[model samples]
Target: MKSQNIRLCFNNTVKALFISALLLFNTNLFAEDLEVTGNITQLGNDWLVVQGYTFYVDQNTELRGPNGSIVQFSFYQLNDLVQVKGNNRGDGTYLATRVKLEDVPNNSNEIELTGYVSAKGTNSFDINGTTFLVDANTIFRGRRGNPFSFDMIQVGMLLEVKALLQTNGDFLATRVKAEDDNHQHGNEVEVTGLIESKSTNSIIIGQWEFFVNSQTVILDRNNLLIGFSQLNVGDRVEVKAFKQLDNTFLAVRIKLEDNPQSQIEIKARIENIIGNDITV
Candidate 1:
């Protein structure tokens, strides 16, 4: 009789175990299911790479993962998700999505650009044979293509760019980076030279070219005061600028460098002073 009782108990235990296993399998399936349409790849330690940039999709953001799991990503790891907004980096990484914490602003509206004054004057900056105007109210917040324009820009120049498009489909920039007292603090800067170029924009000591956007600027008097006509080929200068979408600049004020000074002579004659003198 005791053996028969033991057999009956074993059968009941087996049935309970089978029921427990079924419930656990269902739980796992619910946890790992994906809802969004993308691949799951490791970005870093504390982050996940969803579209292109590094983002942590926790309970804060509306983004979700397969199986309703939250995804977060990191920034300090190699092969990390790049923090760029667009797609294609020329190195086989093409993120077909645009990811951002917030929407990009219309930086094309009212810009400020600062770069070395060109021989064409702040009024006319020619690059690759294309002419662009520089003046007051030009924008400089980089929302356009390419981080920095070609190396044609210099230092110790003033550029104040506007956001208004001209009739010719170009932006109208007012000159503001030069001797303008309003922008006195942004005129001067200390920069090192790139590899072998004599141009003024700072770069690393031995590198062929330095990224211009990462360079520094000094805002002080006597840093950007040189007549545009006095500038020669391969002159080094500092600039305070406002940016446009096309990476153009409008000078606010300008100053010539005193180093390796050039001789600038001015001739003036006093004509007959014709003025209504008020005698007290």
Candidate 2:
């Protein structure tokens, strides 16, 4: 009779242990959340596919674009690169919690660009792969601070542009000024490139070197003054400098591109698997 009671007790203990294991598994399953960053390859009425993962969006999902403005699901378009924060439902379906649009290079409003004009149109032009639209309010100037007409703009000329970025990635020129690239004695020079490296007093953009002294002026996208400490590698910038006799560019003013904030997501990659452990 004692052995019989022991058997019954063992059975009950086994049942309790099994239930606890099952509960733990269920908790771990629902805990899998994921984030993704990639271009939208497919779109649907209620679902979208990015980087081979299908994510479902419902009323609870929050969507935003430039300036952190709330947007609808319909605002997303094909080929738009985006960052998504979501949860994995453990059944191959992802539930989106938030979606943020990433800005395309040279596609934002705050670019103070200097580039050679590639094409000239009646009311617009192409520079550095970006289109600049002009109107009556557009101000034009020459190398000597002289007023010029729109007709003076020609292809193959270097120009400096201060423009506002449009929602659709077009640039509306507030000011268009020509650069006298042929003037060998001209001390003024402008360039736009990603910062390769920097120090407290200098920075390297592409292959060209630039120096920033105490008198140098630096501004962010909002036109607010900033310091060299605020700059970082891989930041795109436009620099207006004076060409020194030694050929090094002395930065008189600098402008950094202020990209909009986007929700960032990344996929987890498993590097190795061992008996019951995984490396990611």
Candidate 3:
């Protein structure tokens, strides 16, 4: 009987040790540092959300700007690109130790785009072949400031978006405002061709001359935002403009085309396919 008690005590001690080790392992796992890079979606007195993850900030947290200069948390704005180093709290949130602001590339642009939704995804939407990513801080509104949600958006719906281009070539939308489909702008014109000539304020495509202004959004062949000064003569482009009361076409958006033809639809029966070649 004494030997039985000793065996029981030994088993109990082993069980306790196993449980202790497991708890330690889990603690270390949760203590691991995590790094996240994305645009700041939401900001609060002591917390910020990035890419749908909430991170708590405290006095110990270090905040730095793009130039590596110390900065205050208040300097950050919604949709500002950032990199965060933190520890997961095991409750779906994080405790940030470092928050650094990232600079927008020179090729990037802050643009206001108005168009029909061409595609939709869980966290993003496409307009005119350009993808716009959305996060918690992206404000959505209907006519007259009525509340709207991302789920309420649909393909073919007209929306006006204000967005910033990220270094990774994604457009992070800051605001999405729905517009009426029937609403039309007067004297809207769209032209596609090589740039015949260009000046400080205008570009010639075919026979139409489109005037560019500070508000004009220029994108490169990769659909990345650029400046009007980056445009060169003989480059292929597509220009969307509106005629002003002064009988001048004001370019609203200018996109560089990747190919001579934007799209080509071929309708033919496939006869055979070999390796990397297909005969139709």
Candidate 4:
């Protein structure tokens, strides 16, 4: 009887251990890999919020910048665009393995364009004639620096955009800020781009309409005086204007420019060299 009792106890113990191991294996099998890109809405010592999802970071988490340079957790800031790769925990949270900053700072490789939004799509918008694509990593802010999203964008709204030029000629918007023209009193706005349309008293560049008054000065590439009628569509120009009380941009000066050369540099290993032609 004593031996039978001991045997029964051991078997029960072994069964409980097997069940526990199975449960652990099942929990791990149900954990899903997760990858998300968005602005960091919140930051804490060991956690971050992106796109309304919380991700916990630990010592093993890898932090990096846009250039893939290793960074510290402290390097992240609220409103900074980031991409998080991790696995979802069963408890409605995620364990991040890597966090990467996605924003490219305003530099020579980037361009700033401010104008009225002429068009908008599901994931992109047009300002001044350039189409800017926005992804989960795009940061949108109001004039007062409050966080916003792409859904706030609408046609005819004045916006300031900072974007990087993509290899395929698309402008990938990194930041978009809503501007209130009413507060722009005496503030000068400048736009440099090809003229998209022209009228007897106004001209449109990209999508920005600038009114030309009798006081408006028009000059050629050489700074020589020119008439308003001399301007035409497709002409490259730099316009200095100010927001009028009625919210219209009134041109103070317009200068024509020679079409600038568009050049792009590519970095890749040369696969083959054949007399003035290289394959990469």
TM-score of each prediction? 0.23, 0.29, 0.34, 0.31
lDDT of 2 by residue, 195-247 (tens): 77998788886456789865465777765567789988888777766555465
lDDT of 1 by residue, 15-51 (tens): 2211111111211121110111122245544345432
lDDT of 3: 0.67
Across residues 107-215, which tens digit of lDDT does each residue of candidate 3 receive?
Answer: 2255555665766899999875668999999999997778789999876566888787787968899999898643323244556777878898999865578887654
Task: Give the candidate number with the greatest TM-score.
Answer: 3
Of candidate 2, the 10-residue stretch with the lowest lDDT total is 17-26
Per the 3 Å backbone cut-off, how many clashing residue pairs does candidate 4 have? 3
The C-alpha stretches of model 3 lying farther than 4 A from their native spots are 1-158, 161-184, 261-280
* CA lDDT, every model vs. true structure: 0.30, 0.64, 0.67, 0.66
Ranking by TM-score: 3, 4, 2, 1
Deviation (Å) of 102 in candidate 2? 18
Instruction: After the best TM-score superposition of candidate 4, give how far the Cα of residue 214 lies from its true spot, in angstroms.
Output: 19
Candidate 3 RMSD to the correct structure: 27.6
Model 1 RMSD to the real structure? 30.1
- Candidate 2 error regions (>4 Å): 1-108, 183-280
* Candidate 1: C-alpha lDDT: 0.30
- Global lDDT for candidate 4? 0.66
The digit string of per-residue lDDT tens for model 4 on 167-221 reads 7868799988887743222234666666778888999864478888754667787
Candidate number achieving the greatest lDDT relative to the actual structure: 3
Pick the winner on lDDT between candidates 1 and 4: 4
lDDT for model 2, on a 0 to 1 scale?
0.64
